[model samples]
Target: MSFAPFSDAPGTLDAAATAARLPWSALAEEIAALLWDSTVSVPARSVLPLAQGGSLFVMPATDRSVAMTKLITFTPGNAGTGRPSIQGDVVVFDIATGERRLVLDGPTVTARRTAAVSLLAARHLAPVPQGPLLIVGAGVQGRAHAEAFVVGLGVQEVWIASRSAASAEALAAHVHALGAQARVVADADAALPHCPLVATCTPAQAVVLSATPRSDAFIAAVGAFTPTMVELAPALCQHVALHGTIVVDTGDAGHEAGDLLQAGLDVATMPMLRNVVCGPWTHGTRAGKGPVLFKSCGWAGWDLAAARLAMRRAAAEPPMPAAAVRVPA
Candidate 1:
């Protein structure tokens, strides 16, 4: 598929412009196709330490159609300097010609693609999604997941919980603005027993939800990427034999998801997101029954896929007045 004029369009996009061009549903659907692809390819992300006490990450993903790379940086000191702790840009390229195509805002790509990963998993793992939902964080991922799920699924009620009461209320308002029934909850426990669906998006260094997950619950834990950072209790996966195995974006996730690594589960032993999307998950008990949850550390493939979708959709629009247009890949 050729991503015409739009893919090769000139000028770098800011966060707002990037969001305007990439629709939530399109992002979820495009990522869905990429997830089930048996041949999906993405090399392990390259991590390097920065001399200033932070880090730099080089992540790239591509296929036969197009390619993209996100050059991101992590600067811990920037947090106190009134600057973003993470910053980067996404560079898209034409697969066949090896020519650079477009440069998109990295944070926007990261936020949308990351949220879409968990939502895509929920789409398949929680096939019977309905009723109230719980979101564990109130930051960017929190907002993105709320929007993606509320827009991509049939979520009726969304409950936001965060360490900061103000943060939770802010996200609740955003969800309500999306035309969904939403409110700020006291904490995760407030909705655990009854809320059938949940997505944890916090930055906590330790476990967040301590209650035993319901047999029918579908939790998407999107926070805690490093080994030292954990967001879910180990019993969740340990009980998969009787309840469910954690659903992950890729086998690679097990290496990054503290929840899985700390649980003593091998990435090779778990059912990946691909398995859930393409066929009956092999990890579930006898008949693929019981509780199901998705854990996402992160993935570059999602960025490549969502960027392509944005380009394809943006190209279909009537020619813009000022943006330069280039030919297809």
Candidate 2:
């Protein structure tokens, strides 16, 4: 039997649409299952650094029925050039036939799916009714987190903090424009007490969020993917040792990320998302904690999952000719 390769156009999904299509809890559960399943394969990503000061990553993943390759680019100056900071394309392939199936734009997908993952961690581990969230860094992650917390987690108030006061104010205004209660804080440290939920989104080489959070607080650090970037302080790692559940995205990435490396933290001993979902909750571990800390290394599995979700949604709509193609021999 000859298989026809269907060329699905790269669909552009806005943040709101993406959120509506892929809920945080559902995506997180899907990711958790994929990670736990022994049949699925997610290899270490391949990175290509741009000479102009950005990087691209190619991530490939596959199971029996589904396979996907996602190309993600991080261009910091793209925002100044009237483009998004992070953008890319995801190509989904038929695992059995090895035929191209679908293509999806990844900018909005990354933002929405990343926020969903963070929200899921908060929902399962963070303290309930945790309000007055503090978001450090006024970048894409900051804005996305605000929306997810408000729409998905029912957060009442959000405080925006950045090294640049103007950026923080602007982010606050943007979130408030969406009808959420949001404001800018002059001092990130001062806002810690009021924030039961804190998200660090900056790409800093040193710890930006150094203030100790309350025992009942929940923290999500989305920055610090590289060995040089650090968002949470050594003290925060100590706090995790003493009182909170320290959940890293993966053991290998955590070993390289500066936040863990600087603090001499070992993810080999830390509880991973896989452990939380599959294992028994024992005392003095991720299973027991009032304040929980989740550090995301931005895995490829997330991009693959988000791409699959987006493709499924795009497939459900009235078929567009742009999404179809004639196969050639």
Predict model 1's lDDT versus the native.
0.76
Query: Could you give candidate 2's per-residue lDDT for residues 171-225 as a string of tens digits?
Result: 8888787677888887888899888898888756457777778888888888778
Candidate that would win on lDDT = 1
Look at candidate 2 and tell me the lDDT of residue 204.
60
lDDT of 1 by residue, 1-329 (tens): 76546554566766777777667888888887886665556999998989987778899988767888989986656633546666888888878876665777787888898888777777677735774788997877789888888888868689888887877888888888889999887868757877878889876466788787777778888786777678888776566535665677877775687887887877666777777666665433323466776878888888888778877866787643444422334
Candidate 2 weakest ten by summed lDDT: 320-329
Q: Global lDDT of each model?
A: 0.76, 0.73
Q: For candidate 2, what is the TM-score?
A: 0.84
Q: How do the predictions measure up, each by TM-score?
A: 0.87, 0.84
Q: Output the number of the TM-score-best candidate.
A: 1
